[model samples]
Target chain A: MNREHDREIVRYRAPTRINHWIVAISFVLAALSGLALFHPALFPLASLFGGGPWTRILHPFIGVVMVVAFVLLAARMWRDNRIDARDRAWLRNVGDVIHNREENLPEVGRFNGGQKLLFWVLVTCVLVLLLSGLVIWRAYFSQWFPIGAIRLSAVAHALFGLILVCSIIVHIYAAIWVKGSLRAMTEGKVSYGWAWRHHRAWFREVVSARRRAD
Target chain B: MALQSLDIVRRSATTTPAPQARGAHSGQVAKLIDVTKCIGCKACQVACMEWNDLRDEVGHCSGHFDNPPDLGGQSWTIMKFAEHEHADGSLEWLIRKDGCMHCADPGCLKACPSPGAIVQYANGIVDFHEENCIGCGYCVTGCPFDVPRISKHDRKAYKCTLCSDRVAVGQEPACVKTCPTGAIVFGSKEDMHEHAAERIEDLKSRGYANAGLYDPAGVGGTHVMYVLHHADQPELYSGLPKNPVISPFVSLWKGAAKPLGLLAIAATAFAGFLHYIGIGPNRTDEHDEREAEREAQRLRAEEHP
Candidate 1:
């Protein structure tokens, strides 16, 4: 509990961690069910969720849940995820960052350039998916639009869905590849070394704030 | 291949070959509608409703004789009426029966993601098997003719089947059988094309020079072909798409896009896996931890000592 002895600092609060996991779980469900419906080769996956009908019925609902959870998470994390001049400098040294030469990079804040870029990409893909989903959603809004509009929306939905799934794959891989990152989400804390080495500017700000509080 | 079930030649979303035994005995059937002979009496529509047992809500007139206004889940077929004036200023009432074309390269079957939801029989009848339908309504988007309608009650797609059930028993479609003037004819595609040629000759003899058959090859020709008087201006008959083909959007979404999307997703995962193998985890060891604690201690000491 004591940061001085534990050598750990709070990286995510309990609410933030819970929100993130909800989004993650929903994304997995939605993606799998969607892919199952998207192609015939993956049709066997429909058995995992009752059958084809159930998978079709559940995917959109799961997507809606994910969108709501992601929106909440994004609202809370937007300030920290914003890209700045220092983040661009960090990106410029991405080769070093990828090779673990963190010392060569600028002082990154709460998020590095790669993470910030992915955040915006996720935002864009999610918004497109939502709009296109409404248009092709046969149960409700599709009849209101013309066939041409529906066809375009169907294509857009598939393309954006592909982008989102790919982006999330990278997101998941980065979280796992960075040794302390999973613990930050799961345990709501990261080691002082993690903060200092990866996000020194944000660490300094946190320390100053702690000093002021004391 | 039995008489009751028309053997399926193609299936939607199917990877393997379809049943092939029913080919030698019967040629592809077609229903030809002679628009010039159609009196717009809607007798065929009435026969369709009775045979299909469809009672679409008796919709009020919408300023035109075309009852029900447009096709719906219940209404499988409707007669579209268009009043046109020749350059000579004489009015001609063009009546066309609007229903499924049952394209040889059916877009509904191609865009369908569910196996056996839409099927094309050897007799060239593109049919909707509602039991297999998941109600995704992809067929509605894929239909070049905009014929399929998803029902609100059961959420299954409904369209004219070209009377596959009747054809199986060696009978013409109810509408064709009931046509008072023989405006609708059901027979082998070859016979119908020959009949349409005779009709076109007769129409030309009557000074209707532009008469031709509307068997659009863009959709590989349709099972339900039309003999239009103004074949040059087929669009004159209720916006009959001048040159209808499956929407390119549907084609890309169902065609190259599928494999490309799968490849992109797989490539992303592969890249991440390769990165991990090449670079390993970016970890902070005990030395880094000690250095970080020492710096924090120095900072606190400077502030509060």
Candidate 2:
């Protein structure tokens, strides 16, 4: 534990931490249900929840919960997700990210351009899924609406789902691409060297803290 | 009588002023196709190929009007046949015109890494610009309708622009113009919504209880809406999934993992800045030296005082 103190420790607030886990758990449930519905070959995946009947019953409910939880998450992070001049520059030189040339890129603050863009994209996708899902919901809205409206909603929902999945794949690959990144979410801290190598500006703040303490 | 005629002319002029009309004319108008009214005529397909100067012999078949099976670089849209058994045990053939949905929150737009390639027009039509496209196939993977087709020649993506050129000139799409049945409706989104509602009510009165309008708030609500005959199981005819979801794993990757990774990078960079300024974790000896020097300076100042 003392060794952990010797290392840099950047902690997320309790709310932020809890919100992340909520999203993580909900996402896993949603992905399994979605896979079962997307193709018959993946129908066996329904067994993860129980069987086809249970999967069908649980899918929409889980989706609703995900949308609600994500909306709350979006509300809290909206300010940080906004694009700024630095973010624009970062996007312009996004090649630096793929090449692992972080030293050449501009010093990023809290969230980088990639992170901000992902946040907004996810938020937009969730909103679309929620609305489209509700419109085409057979048990719920089909009784009140017309067939034409329901068909259109189904198309919109499917399109958004595909886009959201692709964007998320990129998001995952980027996380694994960068070293010491998974630790921030898992252990809630990064090493002193990891901090210095990646976030020089923030590393200075921590060093200043030690100086003030001394 | 002359005063009344002059008042009528003034009312007409005010109501249909050129500036307001021009403002309304400046965007692409989408068409919602009603499958029940279609007769499987391939006139629109031929017109699209001719207008786009696409080759005709690409997906030609023998003794069949269905030229192409699906949308491709050359084929923007096609009419698909859905055969089903009615409650009375008779066979019913439903022909649907399949094309781009032009979703409000288009997946192609989100997945497109290239700027100015896949964009949503002001009128909610998702338009493609080939010049900026990287041919990444991301849009192809992301589109739920499988609308975008990569050109074998140039390797860029192409899809229905909702006839953006024709719509700009206040004309309906070729498919709508050639429809033998009044199945395809082209107009403003609001007008179509009202028309779709009335059509659904008419169908409901005829005992099509499952009939409902399809744009249900998904992907921010699609510009195109559909009126289906089999409202209970429209997916059987529409090629649409009953329950669609944006996989939650995607949310975790975008919302949690990626941002946390970036934060870790920022933290490491901040540590490096400290090291460069000689106050980093690696400079404990230097920090002690600085402290001793500061104490000596304090003693000298005290002695002088």
Which candidate comes out best when scored by DockQ? 1
Q: Pick the candidate with the highest lDDT.
A: 1
* Candidate 2 docking band: incorrect
* For model 2 chain B, the run of ten residues with the poorest summed lDDT: B5-14
In angstroms, the error of model 1 at A27 is 1.3
**Chain A TM-scores of all predicted models:** 0.94, 0.86
DockQ of each: 0.71, 0.02
lDDT of 2 at A165: 64
Residue A61, model 1: lDDT of 88
DockQ (0 to 1) for model 2 = 0.02
| TM-scores vs. true structure, each candidate | 0.95, 0.48
